[model samples]
Target chain A: MQLAIVVNEGPYTHQASDTAYHFTKAALEKGHGITRVFFYHDGVNNGTRLTVPPQDDRNLQKLWSELGEKHGLDMVVCIAAAQRRGILDADEARRHGKDASNIAAGFRISGLGQLIEAGIEADRLVVFGD
Target chain B: MAQKKKFLYLNRKAPHGTIYALESLEVVLIGAAFEQDVSLAFLDDGVFQLMAGQDTTAAGMKNFSRTFKALGDYDVRKFYVERESLAERGLTVEDLMPITYEDENEDYAEKPSIHLVGRAELAAIIADQDVVLSF
Candidate 1:
């Protein structure tokens, strides 16, 4: 089954993100196709290029990026949430005269339409949340 | 396309505290991906999901309430705000931003429709939905 996974937690502080990631990986291992991963609320922070973790810690952002690269997956962050939290892409940051954009490769900042489309298109849209 | 199922995501708790807010987002998005019509209502403590001008850095948490504004991207515009919940907590719809706030009433899409009702009424609303997951 094709599944759409929604992630509402960031890598730190909550296990929500970890749980979603593992679920997606396992689904893939089982030969299920994941339509897309929608990140909202603090989950949007996962798209930031500015994230820096300690050497000993796991780099979840890098892992997500790699997942998208190795396979064709769409990682979408809600724009409204990103903007309210002051997260902008390189284009937006440059256009808004900000210093930089954290929404970079492996993830694209989009409206909820992708989510809607995925939900409609995917066979099963299983949610993993708090 | 499948007929859009009405999905109302009720969010409680602030961003980065626990995974409540994040988990809600995921479920809602997944619902939408399934071509279900999804709406989000912030009530009681859930209203905090739309609070603006947060200082999460002090708490070592990245503020994601602004993500509420992004609901438009998900085609999530219907918001059911409880009047009593706002007043009891000293919060007014004006205090929140980027939300199409509504009072609990017959017109309010939430269950019971009253701005505030007893727990029994709330339960009926939950029972009516194809899905009602809490944060």
Candidate 2:
């Protein structure tokens, strides 16, 4: 089955991100094709490369990036939501006149149309949030 | 040969307090372009989204309550409001806005789009869905 995931909360503050990550990993292990992973609302925080957790704690941003890299996953952060929360890619940062970009590796910024498209293409659309 | 997938937008939060309600509506409008078999389920505080005579002027925000009226124009007509959620909140279907759509096949006659259902019925509706987008 082709699966699409939408994560709606940020890291640390909520368990949504962690649960989504584990569910996604399990889905991949089960040989399910991941059509896309869309980050909306506070979930865009998961795509920032600037997060640095303690030596003991897990780093969700890095884990998602690594997972996307390994599986060639289409991880997309909603541009509207990302911009509202200050998560930006190089092009977005340049356009907004910001000094730096913090979009993590393996995640791209796109429109909500990608989400609707995921619903159209994927057999299952799973959501994890508050 | 991709078939028309049964897509259900599960809304469980109130409008204005969170962005979920508004953004979820936006996705529904956009998804209509894909011509999928779409239905919307309003449960929990989500039933407040369809409350009639909502004025956001005092709150200083865009009053998007009117947008619900335009949904039928996009050929997205199914709206299931959970009966228990409304009763729990001391609300009845009469408190909600009258949302209707024109049925062209039936001589373009007007028909109510909102359907009130029990929790079990709503669960059955969810189980029938191929894709459930919760907000």
Candidate 3:
């Protein structure tokens, strides 16, 4: 089964981000396929390649990258939301004239159409929110 | 073959907190207005929306939960509850507003239908949807 899991919470607070990650991992372990991991609202922060957590803590951004690489999961950040929150890719950063953009590897900016596609293409679409 | 769009709305916020529900409602209404089929499913805290008797008037909010009943008027007849969430909250269909659903069918349909499933089965819902938006 292919799943499109959405995370709507920021990485710092709320369990939605963690829940999305755990659910994705479990889905893979259970032999289900993940079509994409769409991040919206503050959840776009998960794609920020520049976030710095304490050395003692797990770098969630890296974990997400590993998940994407290992399972080939599509980590799509909402383009409008990501821009509003300053989570930009290299191109977006250049477009917006921002000094830095931290979009993590394996994550890309996409449109609402992607969300719609997720629902149609995926067998299950799970949303994690605050 | 030409077919109507099968749209699923993923509402993640509580009513009255923000415009998420209201905005989502507009999108669904627009889709239905354009002749597409629409369905709604609640997950996690979103399940709270299905609970009965929401009184947000005192909070200076538009009784948005009241708008749920109107979804039927807009041809959005399928309202679903995540069975696991209900169980975790010690709630059930009986605890929610009278929402119509085909509890028997496990597969997706053109008409509105409710799916009562566990976590494992929930993954299938994600896999089956053509479009999924979280609000």
- Model 3 chain B lDDT-worst window of ten: B101-110
Poorest 10 consecutive residues of model 1 chain A by lDDT? A121-130
Q: Mind giving the per-residue lDDT tens digits that candidate 1 earns over A1-130?
A: 8888878667787888888888898899899998899887677888887889999998888888888887788889878667767779987788789987888579988876676666666776666555
lDDT per residue for candidate 3 within A63-130, as digits (tens), equals 89999999888889978778878888889889888898788999999875566566656777788886
TM-score, chain A, candidate 3: 0.95
Which has the greatest DockQ? 2
- The i-RMS of every model, in angstroms, reads 5.5, 1.4, 4.3
- Expressed as tens digits, the lDDT of each residue in B1-135 for candidate 2 is 267888899999999977889888878887888888999999999999999999989888778989899899888899999999999999999999999999999998999999999999999999998888899
DockQ values of all predictions:
0.11, 0.68, 0.12
- Candidate 2: interface RMSD equals 1.4
Candidate 1 vs candidate 2: which has greater lDDT? 2
Superposition error at B105 for model 3 (Å): 29
lDDT of each: 0.69, 0.93, 0.75
Alpha-carbon TM-score of each model against the true structure: 0.61, 0.94, 0.60
Score chain A of each prediction against the true chain A by TM-score and list the results. 0.93, 0.99, 0.95
lDDT by residue for model 3 (B16-135), tens? 676567656655655555545676878777777777888886788777666676666666777656788888888887778765433235563344334566766666765666566667
Better of 1 and 2 by TM-score: 2
Per-candidate chain B TM: 0.71, 0.97, 0.78
lDDT of 1 at B28: 68
Q: Model 3: iRMSD?
A: 4.3
